[model samples]
Target chain A: MPLTSPDRTTGPLMVIGGAEDKLRKRTILKEFVSASGGADARIALIPTASSLGDEVVEVYDALFRRLGAGEVVPVRPQSREEAHDPDLVKAVGEATGVFMTGGNQLKLSAIICGTPLGDAIVEAHERGAVVGGTSAGASIQSSHMVAFGVGGATPKQRMTQVAAGLGLVKSAVIDQHFDQRNRYGRLLMIVAQSPQLLGIGVDEDTCALITVEEDADEVPHEVLRVIGRGSVTIFDPASIVSNAHEAKRSSPLLASGVLLHVLPAGAAYDLTTRTLVPQPAAIDPEDAAELAEAQRDMRQLARDIAAADASPAALRRRLARTRTKIGPNPDPLEGPVS
Target chain B: MPLTSPDRTTGPLMVIGGAEDKLRKRTILKEFVSASGGADARIALIPTASSLGDEVVEVYDALFRRLGAGEVVPVRPQSREEAHDPDLVKAVGEATGVFMTGGNQLKLSAIICGTPLGDAIVEAHERGAVVGGTSAGASIQSSHMVAFGVGGATPKQRMTQVAAGLGLVKSAVIDQHFDQRNRYGRLLMIVAQSPQLLGIGVDEDTCALITVEEDADEVPHEVLRVIGRGSVTIFDPASIVSNAHEAKRSSPLLASGVLLHVLPAGAAYDLTTRTLVPQPAAIDPEDAAELAEAQRDMRQLARDIAAADASPAALRRRLARTRTKIGPNPDPLEGPVS
Candidate 1:
C-alpha cells in the first residue's frame, strides 16, 4: 500500500539535512521563500530546536531580510501554554512559510507535539503553507523522529532511539547529517524495526523535496526530488526478510532484499513507481571530445614547456601561453571567454 | 556500463555471513560441498584467518566429514613463503571447494596475497571451483579489504582503513560481521573514497552466493542468491551523491541516493540488471489465514492458562485443552496434528 496522502492543499516539504548553505547559496531557504509566494511572502522562523535562542533568530532574521522576505517573524514559545499564545498562533496561521532550526530532535518533538503552535503549523500546512526544517528540524517533521542515540552501521538493539514528532510526513523517517554522521545504520535499524516506514537518510546540505500529488486510487502519490550538493540514501524495507526477531539483543541485524535507492542531484524519485525517474544522460559526445582534445593539447603544451624550463613558475607561464593558442571551440558556449 | 567481466572461468563465489550452522542443515556449508561436486568432492580448509588454528581445522574437518564430503584436508602456513608449499598448492588444485575460516581479515589477506597457495586458489577458481569464506575469511576475499578500524555509525577518514586483498572480487568491498559490529559505516567510507566499488555488508549467518555466469559481451553476468537465516546488505555507491571529497575530514559524510539491497534466504539479485529477481511471495492466503487464527487462539489460550495457573506445567496443560476448543484450521495442512 502507498503512503496515505496529506490533504490536497498541504504545501510540499523542503526537508533539509543539516549544515545548509546559510551563507552562500541558501538554495533551500530561497525555495522556502518561493514556496511561501516569493520575497514579499510572510514567513515565520521557529528557533525552538536551537539552544542558541536569540543569536539563532537574529541570524535567520538577517538572512530572510537579505533574501527580501517582506514579513519575517521570529517565534519562540517557552511552553505549550505560550505555544497557544494567540499572537504566536496568529503569526503561524498568517504565515506562508514556517522554518524550523536545527538542534536536539527530542527537544523539538517534545515542544511541538500537542502544542497549539504545532496544531497551528499543521493547519497552516493544510492551508498550503510550505514547512521546512534543517537537521533536528528535519527529523522532527517525520512521524517517528529519531530522538537521540549512539551511531553504528549495523542494526543492533538499542543502537537508536525514536520518539513521536509533528508527523508532517507520514510514510517516511528522515535523518539529517546522514553520511557525515554515519547515520545510515541508525536509520536502517529504525526501518528494520518499522518496515512500514521508508528510511530517508539525507546528507548534509541536501534537500529531500517531498511533493504530494492527487492520490491515484488507494495509492498515495508523493514525489521526492533530491536537491543540493549531497545525496539522499533511502532504505525501503517493505520486502525485507530477517531474523531480527530471533536474534540476540546484541546480534547484528539480518535483513534481506531491502530495496535501496540513491538519488543524486538532477534526480527525481516517484514513490508510486518505486523507481528513480530515468533522465537521459546529460554528457554530450561533442563536449567529451572537446575535453579529451583539450587534455591532449594541454599535455603537449606541458611537454614543450618542460623542454624549455622545468620550474613550477615556468610551467605556469607556458600554461598561460597555450590557453590562447588553442584553436576556436566548436560550440560558441565552449569558446574561450576572451 | 556494467561490471567488467573477468576473462576466466572464475567459479561463482559463495560469501557467507558469520555463524553459519555447522551442525544441522548446514545449508551454506553443504552448498559449498555440493558446489565442489557432491560427496566425492575434495575440499581444502585454510585456517590461517582463524586464531583458533588447529581447533578451527578440527571443527570444519569434522563438519565436512559429517556432511559426507570426501577428502577434507587442513592447511596452515605461518608465513607468505610457507604459503608457497607445493603440497598446499596440490591440495587446492585437487579441491572443488577451498574454504577460509573466520578470524582477523587482515591476517588472512596478509598471509594469502602473492603466495603460491593464493595463486593456486585463484587458478582453482578459474577452473570452476567454489571459494567460500565466513567472517574475517569473507572480508579477505575482496580486492580492498577493511583493515582494523573503530566501530561507529558515522563515516570518518580513519574510522575505516582499507588494505589490498587477494582481488578475488574486484567491484565490491566486503565487510564481515557487518550487522553485528556495526560495520556499515566502514564499508560506506570505503565506497565514498572509491565510488566505483560496491560495499557488500554480509549479515551474520547469511550467504551472498555471487555466481559469475558466462559473460555475454562486455557485461559481466553475476547472480547473487542469499542463503541462511540472515540477509545481506549491499551498498552500491555507483549513483551516490556524497561530499566526501569536499567536506572537511571530521565533517559528517554527505551521500545521497546510494543503492542498497538486503537479500534474504532464497532471494536473488542480478548484478547486470542492478535489480532483484522478483519472486512470488511464499505464504499463501490460506496459510496466512490459518496462522492468524492460530495466533488468535494462542492468545486466548494464554489468557486461559494465566487465569487457571501461572506455572509452566499448568500452562502446558491449558494449551493442550484449548487446541480442541479453537475452531477448525483454515487449511488441512495447518490443522492440529491430533
Candidate 2:
C-alpha cells in the first residue's frame, strides 16, 4: 500500500533486544541518535515500562545528550488515565525521536496499548519520527506480544501467553533476550499456534532497524537490518506442523517444518515478500577510484618483481628507479626488500 | 502462476526426514502408496543415491508390492550415460509414483542433475505422478541442495555447501536428519548468506507432504502438511543480518533476525504466502450426529440423576427403567450404579 502512496513516508523503527550499550561502544544508541536527526533531534523518553523511577529517565537523558541529541524529555504514564493525559501526548507528538526503556513489557502494554499516548506515538511514526525501544519496549512493537513464557527449545502448549502490542510491526510477534535468555521455545510455541504471525527473536544488545524501501518491481516493502553486537533470529513457519492446540499443559509440542533464518549484523530481510533482501555492493566512488589506483600500482610492482627474477640487487635497483620516477618519496606500494 | 493456470497440475511431493519406519505402522510409506493410486499403483524406485547395490531397490520393490502396488520397477542410473538411456527414462515416466532412497545427496545430484533422467522426473511430476524421497532424497527435492554440511546450532562460515536439486520445491533448500543430526547451523548458514533461499529442516521419521491447494481468494498455492512422528522446521529469513559474506574460514557467523516455524503432524503451511494455512474444522457427519445424540442422552441422564438425588435405590430403579425402555440392552454409556 505504501508503494502506491508515493508521498507516504513513515519513520524508521528500531527494535532493540534489551541491554543496549549505554556505556562503551553504544553502537545501537548512536545509530538511533543519527536516525532521529542527530544534533537536531528532540527525543522523548517513555520510562513507564521500567520499575526504576526518575533514575532511568535521567540516565537516558544524559546518554542522549552525550550522543548529541538536541533535546530530551520524559513522558512517563504510570496508568491508562495518566497515558491519556494531553501533556504527555503532546510531548511524544512534538519529539523527532521516541525511546522506551526496558522493564516489564506486560506493564507497558497494559498502560499504553489503547491510550492516547500510544496513538500519539503511532502518529509520530506516521509523520516520520524515529521510534525505538529495548526489551519491554521491543516486545511491545509487534501486534502479538509475548506476555510471559518459559525458556527452552521445545515448543509446548500454554508455554507462553500473548498480549496485544502497539502493532508497529504488523502480523508478527517479537521476543527479546533470545539466545541469552533462551526464549526460543516460547517464541516457537507462539508461532506454532498462530502460524499466520511471524516470530522474531532478537538477542541482547542487538537492534532490528526497520525501514521502508522499494523493490526492483518498485513495490514498497519494509526491510529489517540488524545493528549491534548480537544477531536477530526470525521464524517464518510457512508450512508448519504442530500439535500446539492439543498438547496438554507444558508438554513438548511436535513442531515440524519450520523455516528458520538467523541473520547477524548487515543482513537485510524483506517483510512484504517474506524473503531476505540482498545487500547492494556499496562502495563509495572515491573509495573505488582510490582502490583501483592502488590495485594498478600493485600489479605494476609485481611485474617489476617478476622481471627482476627476485635478485636482491635487481629488486633494489628497480625499487630505486620507481622511487626516482615518483619524485623521491618511498613508494607506498613498494616496501623495502628484506 | 499455478493459481492463474487452472489446468496446470503438479504431483504431490513428500520430502521425508530420513529413517521413516519400514516396519511398525509405516505411516509415511502407506500414505505414499495411497497417493500413488494404491492397489492399481505402478511404483518406480530410483536408488541412485544409495551405496548399497541391489539391496535398497529390492527392499523398496518388495515393500511396494507388499503394500499392494500392482507393479514395482527398479530404474537406477549408475552414470550420466545410464541416466540418458531411454529405457530408464521410460520406466520413471510410466510409473504412478517415483521414489528416491536415502544416501549421498551430492552423488545423487551429480548423476541426476542436467541428465535426461532428471528431466524425465520433472516431466513426471508435471504430469501429476506422486514423487517421494527420504533423507538425501529429501534434500535433493528443492532448488538448492545441501550437498554436505556439519551439524550444530551456531552458524559458521563454510558450514555447508549447496548443490542443485530437482527444484520441485522452488526457492528453498532442504536438510534431512535435522534436529536428530543437529543440522540447524548449516541450514541457518545457507540462508544467512543467500538470504533469498528459504531454509527447511526436517526431523527424523517425519515427512513434509506438499500438495497444491487453492486459497480463499481461489489462488493456487503449495501447502506442506506434516506426517509421521517428528517435526518440520522452516526458516523464513525475511530480514536477516548475517556476517556470512565476510566471516573468515570456520569462524562462527552472526545470523540475526531469522524467523523460525516448527510444525508437527497435521500442520499445514502455505509456501506462497509464507504463512500457515488454517486447517479446516474436519468432522465426519455421521460421527457428529452420533456425538450429538450421545450428548443429548448424557444430559437427560444427568437430569434423571438430579431428580433421583444420588439415592442408591432410586439410581438402580432409573437404570432398570432405562434398560427396560431399551428392550433389555445394556446402556453403552452407563455402568452399574457402583
**Per-prediction DockQ, in order?**
0.20, 0.18
Write candidate 2's Cα lDDT for B1-338 as tens digits: 12223223899999999999988888999999999998989888899999995999888888888888888889889998899999999999898999999999888999998998999888888899999999999999999999997765557789799989999888899998875676767888898888888888887889999988886687777888989877787887776666666576775576655656677677778787777766664455775786677777777777777878758787778778878787664353753222
Models, CA RMSD each: 10.7, 12.8
TM-score of the second chain in each model?
0.80, 0.83
Q: After superposition, how far is residue B337 of candidate 1 from its true place, in Å?
A: 23
lDDT, candidate 2, at A46? 96
Best by TM-score: 1
What is candidate 1's CA lDDT for residue B149? Answer: 82
Candidate 2 deviant stretches above 4 angstroms: A1-187, A190-245, A248-338, B1-7, B216-218, B241-243, B281-338
* Predictions in order: lDDT: 0.76, 0.83
Off by over 4 Å in 1: A2-8, A33-38, A157-162, A212-221, A242-254, A280-338, B1-84, B87-115, B122-136, B142-173, B177-199, B203-231, B235-338
Q: Quote each prediction's TM-score.
A: 0.61, 0.54
Clashes of 1: 23
